[model samples]
Target: MTVDRRGVLLAGTGGAFGLYSWAAGAAAPAPKRLKLRRRHGVRPKNILVVLTDDHRYDAMGFMKAQSFGDTPTLDRLAREGVHFRNAFVTTALCSPSRASIFTGLYAHQHRVVDNNHPIPPGLIYYPEYLRAAGYETALIGKWHMGVETDTPQPGFDRWVSFKGQGDYLPGPNGLNVDGAKVPQRGYITDELTDYALDWIGKRSGKRPWMLHLAHKAVHSEFIPAERHKGRYTNQTFRYPDSMRPKVPGRPMWVENQRNSWHGVGYPYHGTLDVGDYYKRYMETLLAVDEGLARIMDLLARRGELDDTLILYMGDNGFMFGEHGLIDKRAAYEESMRVPMLMRCPSLFGPGEVSQVVANIDVAPTMLAAAGLVAPDGLAGADMLPLARGEEAPWRTELIYEYYWERNFPQTPTVHALREDRYKYVHFHGIWDVDELYDLATDPNENNNLLARPGHEELAERMSAKLFRLLEETGGMQIPLSADAGERNELRDPKGPAQAPFPPRFFRPPGT
Candidate 1:
């Protein structure tokens, strides 16, 4: 089915995207237009995009993460530019989310559902659009789309990347600097920043430039730079409210997940210490902030800080013991909601934007900023109008999908729909019950309202909307490919794993 999401909302990361709407009645917000209206009908000449892995929506100091202080740089951006308080990624996984950001298409459209899949050779990445428009483009670090190679892809002129999850330490296999095997001497985060700075200083581009500075820090095995190793040792790290998933109304799957590979109870088959884990994760991010500062300083030195669009986001969010899960892909808010901030001082003034945005919007927004229109089938809208608080129809709901992954098989395939105040989750290939939450009241999503009598109609409405999105996006029908030798070949071998949520929400005979 062809999904007419132009005026609506639909997005997917691994397998599906979300559909969103306002809760019941929400007065339209005032337009927040920028002062610098596209110089000569073209965006600024320089654009710097920095992407991180596993950075959650509330992880920054400005968001008031409990006991997690000292993100002054990120907080400054929130203070100086537009803060997307409701940012999310449709599929909350690394490869798929990154691909969505590059192509402006959902995971199913671009066909990179999981970490192992590759984009088709002919697919055009937005970098190609920028490069074709005479902008010098470069990609530095962590380009793990498919088959993890450091060789250059379609878009960028200069490439600096490594194999899957490049080591935090400068190992024997250093960075692949534009196809040359260059040795590394410093921390990977700092080293990556050095390469990016060098390129920014030396690039021969009178006609604008775009830099994709993707970082490898703050992923698993959180490694902090030497200077920051013990920075937070004395501070107390606070745990999430839902860290202990002993609540009665919680669904069976959420309860069972605590003992799995990605569970807080048994993280990576070792001791799971939430406090220590939080500390290490926060420490690792310190270097990322320092790197951002250096980049901003570079832009300021070149007299382009205010004029350039500097966007920061995470590829996907990480689950920090929310729903008893410690990793992404569970259709929970912790796994999907990401940090997004954009600052171009001369163009956009400081303010907070409550409109929902996603990774898929990045490509189209960048293309539009460069005075180019997105391709025909792009699933996301250019966010310039929304960012400017201009009067354009913004997203009302978000649709999300996640195909089961072989590496982490505990979590089932999922489809979800979220709006201003509610979230509906449907599990595929699992016997567990579906979940419904009134996010306005239960922001932590601790209470499940699926079986409650009074909430049935609301579930029915949300479920119907979810399936409409599924049919339109070809979400349920899309097939995944994998290697037989790798033991990742997928064919549901059990009792035709039923869609846990009824097509139109209804109770069973017993209920």
Candidate 2:
């Protein structure tokens, strides 16, 4: 409630505009300590957050999105816990989404808009707050943010991570263990799980601990563990209806991207069949699932299964050929939506939650689980109460943003507003047309109703809401950083070409 009104809140946004006490000066520092509170009848529990990269929302066995997709560990977690059915990320890239999860701020607010951007100086991670509250924390896996350094970050007693996207198999760059270089012994997923279990086993003290086990599986160059390599080879791949070459009202940019590196037609700029790639991706995810099973088994053996808060989520969703696109960074469902499952029988019952949740909600939820209130200026709300079936005000609309990256120039800067039944996407720094989807009826997003008659008012209203949300959250200004990552301009010679000039740009003399 102590807000320094830096600017007047925009009218009708149902939000405020101000800075927290921590945002007072240049190089504003993250609060080194958090105030802890005691809750009635709810004891602080061990928290284990299992995060996977590029794992989409519906890829679990329960959803059956892919006939071959089966995640027994993930499915059991959902069955035993609360499944946030409509969880999404504000930004669909890895680093930005991870940063949002850690800071409880939007990518624009945290200023890690793209994968290459480093964690802004002085931005506090959520774990730091937990650490301050007397919780032992360890981050054991990929820390791709803060620019490529595997060095130990603050706020954790135990630190085990790799430089950017550590390989599935041990490559040149090995593991970084508490600021020391340790050779990656075996498969990355299994090894990370080993580190996590080892840490948990050694915790014979009274203080509750929190561990963030981030996995490198199911990412690009999808490599499955030796045992899971050919697990789904016999299953048939079901292509999404929207993956067809043409869809009415589809943006030209999406069409032109079909032959580029992240497209269905020529994925990876070669003859990589998306079907096979998807199979491999599913195979790669099996190891992560097994790792989760191991974690749960350990907790159960220690009589802490029901006492621990176990959460499994994907950093961001992936696209296996939706809208002629093969990767994320788009406002499409498969790209922005991610799986979020949380379990702690001592705290809440198991059921499906329809309320929309996102990466930003993670921090406040964790802090709430620890019986502490999140500091002001965090854009996310605590979902633990909501999950307990408490009647709290929930967001009716969600805002999504993805800044254009120089390395991947195919997808433009995207801004979108997602409501229960409708989604409106706006493109920036490009000449492409905007998009609107009626998700309830057109789940595939095969149609863009933005240009349709009688839908103009709806589009305008959603667009207004989108911009107002962005403005209210201090996302009106685009964050630009020095260009990093290798740029790829290659296109398939025989792939589909770009479309002609749009009519909005120029009109024939009489037409």
Candidate 3:
């Protein structure tokens, strides 16, 4: 089936590329007129994008993935604007995902597949287009693209950022404030918000502004603010069912990882409990929630709350004891899907958008809101029409890729095809069995159906489609850069036993 620009379903050729062309084709064109025009006249809209690290999709009060997750501010954004319930990232890592958001290209396309890689030269960030269109741009908080420096990059008028995965508290070397090193005054979350609000309030001209307030909270070694510390210490956690030991049909490598660094039995060197770690992560997220409230309040007080386009999203989703894993860089739902909410009453009203949107779509959406078109060859479409409840042709499947890192070798390279109701994950350079899950029936991915009696053709078709996406999008070659960060492949001496090889690997007596 092929969908046209008007979203009309039509009969099409039946081939590998015929049925799935629209999903992996070039981005759809923008509407003839955007929603940036106001009642008074045509004017560009202000944009504010707030990003958090390792936030899960259902970790909000409304979604209730956690029993004690409180996010009144984020809930308000979903209540007042468009909630992208099915948002995901192509690569579930900090630098690669952030690079995708800025450049509107896949990690392989932009050549920033790993955290230590730098943004390839001559690549223009979409914010530069917004700046060229007479809008001021500012970047505050974490910019983990090029792990070497915190100095300002192009496309932003004002810059306030820190080094890679900056310290939760003030460190020996403080923040880099527009080419100067300054002492971090308070908690990283609140201090980043202070810089963001200061920049937003100090603009003196009539030009619309774009601010990217990225927070470093909620990352590993989680540390909550003074007021929010131990907030969820007493709350109970609802662990995932897939975390059970010796789950039937579970991949052997996933079971073996239970004793590795990212596994549940020995998470963070066996010194961390999954429940306590999860509580701390949620607690650390509280300050980010409060910061959102403050930004919204300031915009409301200035009478621009409804007019300004505000977006709240996460760089990548974190896992909590899912499939015996604790971090991202895997193809599981909890590791790739993130919370994405956008509010601009001038563009759209309160509702939910069910389409599968990715981090690569953010750049085009922001450019569309500012009445500017994104550059050619972007891998994402303008999602404003979908947010406005308009019928538009969209992708039916998303390709997720994660390159193997020398720092964390427990998880292998992953390339998966995620459809609405099914997923097929392929592992590279490993001897483990691949995974296939019927998400509609088994959302937890407890039962892998790769060896099922009647699902062989389904898995074969999906696997073929997965590789075609990579071959078509120039992702066939893996990009390698200088390896950095500490190697964390160490396993606890007395942890759980390594998973044995699958029984299928052994031959029958007759054979």
List the candidate 2 regions with Cα displacement exceeding 4 Å: 1-33, 36-41, 501-507
lDDT string for model 3 (403-509, tens) is 89999888888999999999999998888778899999998888889744568889999999988988887677664545678999888889888887766577878
RMSD of each: 9.1, 4.4, 7.6
Best by TM-score: 2
Residue 314 displacement (Å), model 3: 0.4
Task: Return the TM-score for candidate 2, rounded to 2 decimals.
Answer: 0.93
lDDT of 1 by residue, 262-378 (tens): 776667666768677878888999999999999899878987788888899998888877777787887888889999999987666888888878998998888777777666667
TM-scores for the candidates: 0.87, 0.93, 0.91
What range of 10 consecutive residues in model 3 has the weakest lDDT sum? 30-39
**Mind sharing the TM-score for model 1?**
0.87
User: Pairs clashing in candidate 3?
Assistant: none
**What is residue 120's positional error in candidate 1, in angstroms?**
2.1
Steric clashes per prediction? 19, 0, 0
Whole-structure CA lDDT of model 2: 0.83
Global lDDT of each model? 0.77, 0.83, 0.84
Superposed by TM-score, candidate 2 places the C-alpha of residue 456 at a distance from the truth, in angstroms, of 1.4
